[model samples]
Target: MSYSTLPRIPSGWSQSDSQASTSPVSPEEGVVQSVIKIPSTTYLGVESTVAPTPQFERNTADLTSNERAALLASSSSAVAGSAADAPDQWAWRDVGCEARTLGRLSAPITLAASLQILNILVPGMVLGRLGTDAIAASALAMSVASFSAAAPLIGLLSALDTLCSQAATGSSRPGLPGIYLQRCLLLCIASFIPSVILWWNIHPIFIYLRQDPVIAAMAAHYLRYVTFSLFFTLAFESIKKFFIAQGFHHAISLVQVLGTPITLASVYFLAVHPATSIGYVGIPASVAISYALSSLMAFAWLKTYGGSRGWTGLSWEAFRGWGRMARLAVPGAVMVSSEIVALDLLTVATSYLGPTALAAQAIVSMTIQSSGTLLMGLSAVTANRVGNLLGLAQPHRARNAATAALGCGTIVGIVLGVILYSLRGQWSYIFNPDPEVHAIVKRMIPLLASLLALTVITALSLGILRGQGRPKIGAYMNLASFYLVAAPVGFLTLRYTSMGIVGLWLSFFMAVLTSGLGQLVFLLRTNWYDQVLKCEARLAHDGHHEGLMTPENHPSA
Candidate 1:
């Protein structure tokens, strides 16, 4: 029935564009907006509300420019108050718009992320040329570095996905994003010190864990050398996150372009060149120098072009939000690290399988790592999209962006899976010369290829959870999946039967399915509007109350 003939208005019906254009509308309300009151969550998720008034009060602070646009767009209510309800039924045009945006965003990130992988892969190649044992040691070190340093660093900074993206999008306060950046950087640096010490003294720990003594000694040495480089790596990552939050990532790509070649050249010169052949130590040293240089370049770019992004200068206020940020950061790290941690633990266990098996497992694991990190490019984009839209209180658009990310993830997974599958025989050659390693990797490649889509889905879903400020959900899900289901299945399959490394990869199918499908289902149940409320509540609690993000002077605002 027509709106004119309707007896009473429906709660969530959206008016058509023609009807909206012909009718009078309020700036504060939509063309045919809801008279129904917002169900309050009251200071995050405290949940207390009164009877709906004939007219309800709305906060002006929550009415950012984006919120105003969302209100105007509410003319199409089939999309309706269902924002927090489901992850489907988005307009085709909106999906196309988001896909185009995601494509453009993915370019710089994909380049940067691929270059980051090169820093890991090229070093392994350098080690491969040294010897089989050397390549095996390098793999062990890489796995250790992943969970010990890289995972924690990435996790701590994951909060930037939520805070910086929201601050950049929803707040008039430009410096707000930078404030969150500063806070995350501080936490990461603090976390790094303990990790450095652990690496320095890891020989005994590795021995205690029953790793091969010689390989453990070598891996321990690598971590110690790598520790010095990690600081610079941290610096580069911190600055890049700031760039990402602002949606300007060309600079990060540029830094990677310069940094990748320099890293590779240094690896060759220091490891292979007769003049400075430092043997094994050269690999870590080159990585150190490369990161230091890249960090400097990224910082320089931020200083010159960052004014528009709201980082006026560092403030003492950056010290205040430690508690608020950590709540997310710790979970973010857990969520991001859970799978990596599981794999690393498996890598540790693989040491018992002998050097050849260890080497083969490393190659396959590296192949998987490369694909997963590459997908991180898209994951980062998805996180930014969801966070920004939510900050504007545009739940419908946020939901749409999320669904769009999943679609993009599928396409990317298919393309990458094809490439990996096609390269199954020769792919391990890049990391090692051993015919045995190549054969093992070739065997595992099919299984790895099958997991590509699932990995992409999990990565994107985690990003969405991060953006939603519900990272702990992913952390919980991943921990349960990895420790409870996947790891047990893998260890039992490998030990009880003679399936070997193939069994290990086969076991991962459970982890992927458990976490991926679980997160996907949970995303369907998300209350998008409630998420918006939580975002605002978090910002007000952390950014506004602390007087760090907004331009206004009063601490009491």
Candidate 2:
């Protein structure tokens, strides 16, 4: 088992004891590589060699043409063994493979992000045209929607980032991805119940919180019109994850691109046309219609052009995996909700400062969100890459993927920070024309830039955690950093100090920094081998009894 003597497993291929000494082959050889197995342990520091299962070898040739192409692309480098044995021997050292994987995942997501930003911006712009009352109402409505409905739903749906990516690489079953999508749909629909109730009663809730009665009533009306689109939005999210997990990233971009103009047109028409009864509520209604159309298009694409290999059609099997899905979904929901709630709390605190302060905060917040889209795309890349490696039972490669993602995040953060810093004084002009708001935004730019860098790190870490099936860890970190650390500092600074809005943003900066550091530590300390085992256990518990390379199935056993 010396490092030099160890066989070179092709990039996407795995090897067992018998194959450990096999020489690397060219892609032309068409060798059907088996899944690699970690050496079994009989006692502390004692290893047992296991032969490859004949069944696995026999089934290798059954891989689909696309699967074969994927393997070939990845096989350009030798697979690295466990990090415990040789930490520096990871396969991601192949700069080509790393770049190809990262680039492939990042490109489409970045494009899709433009559409997402447009989705946010168009509504705000349309409302701004109607008057300050409309602008205030739309802002409040969006905040409430994010906190009460969208964040939780997005969090819950995030579980698919783990389930679908792992299943894509780990399971031999073709129907697993579709089944997971079904489960996600069911979970989202169930969660939508509470969201509906919250949106329906949001007016009273906002009033009770002492928000402006006029804005509260207007926002409530907006939510009422938009509530019908919740299920469609969640469905689109689920389908998007399905595509991303399977390396169909461009399809998502296409869907978003096609939907964006429709979104813009619908919003413009509804908001400007006097004949429309919707009025201010038309902004959300247009958003709803856009989501529905986008989701339908995505579904149609999935069924037709996109590989429907994993989709076995509707089944009762979707209803069967609730327990396991919840293990990831619940924590994911909390992690997402915590962050959104923290931002909303900051919004509330700023409101107390006056309309000018609130307007300034919105411009800054929107800018940060827009600039962070590239990093969010990178986060999705990290989740898929890490999950795929773990699924292949390659802990060292998974670790490398996580490291690469963090490095990428840092580099991207620095670039974005520089851009934000350079544009600090002028960026807010795109959102608001008020000179007072611009002044406050100028004062906040330094803090906002710093927060942007920190957020990029935190977001990527959370993605890594999700990929590793450790959403609960992210949840705990968010709770501590945001609620325990950031919120208190923000409240004290806002109330007891002269820092004003700058103080609130500084607290946010501190919270994001804390979260990023916490996640980085957790990632460094992770037992990736244990994670491999956990993935196996999850696959087994889900009754996917095929394609697993467990210790019990080792030849030594």
Candidate 1 lDDT at 466 equals 88
Misplaced by over 4 Å in model 2 are 1-85, 273-277, 547-557
How accurate locally, in lDDT, is each candidate?
0.72, 0.71
For model 1, how does the per-residue alpha-carbon lDDT over 1-557 read when each residue is reduced to its tens digit?
00111111123434332223333223343222222123322222111121112222133223222222221122232233332223334567666665665666678789788877887787777788888777788789878888988887888888888888777655546578778888888889888887887788888988888888888888888787788777777777777767776766676778888999999999989999988878887888897899899888877776775433447678888888798889999999999888888888777777778899899887777777777767766777788778876664556667778888888888888888888899887898998888987888888887888888678888999999988989999999999999899889988988899888888777777887898988998898786655765665577665543311221321112
- Give TM-scores for every candidate, taking all chains together and pairing residue i with residue i: 0.82, 0.84
Report the Cα lDDT for candidate 2.
0.71
Clashes of each: 4, 2
Please write out the lDDT profile of model 2 over residues 1-557, one tens digit for every residue.
32222233433343343244544323453322333344432211222222224453344334323332232124333332333344334444543445555665677788788678887776766665676677666667767777877788889988988888877766656678789899988988887888788888777788898888887788788788768766677777788778777767777888988998988888878887777636878877787888899988988987887657568799898898798899999999998778877887777777778777887777776776576556656776788778876775666667767777777778778777888899987876767777887899988888788778778888989999999899999999989999899989998998899989899888888888888788888887786655765665566656445544343442112
- The residue pairs in collision within model 2 are 11-75, 14-36
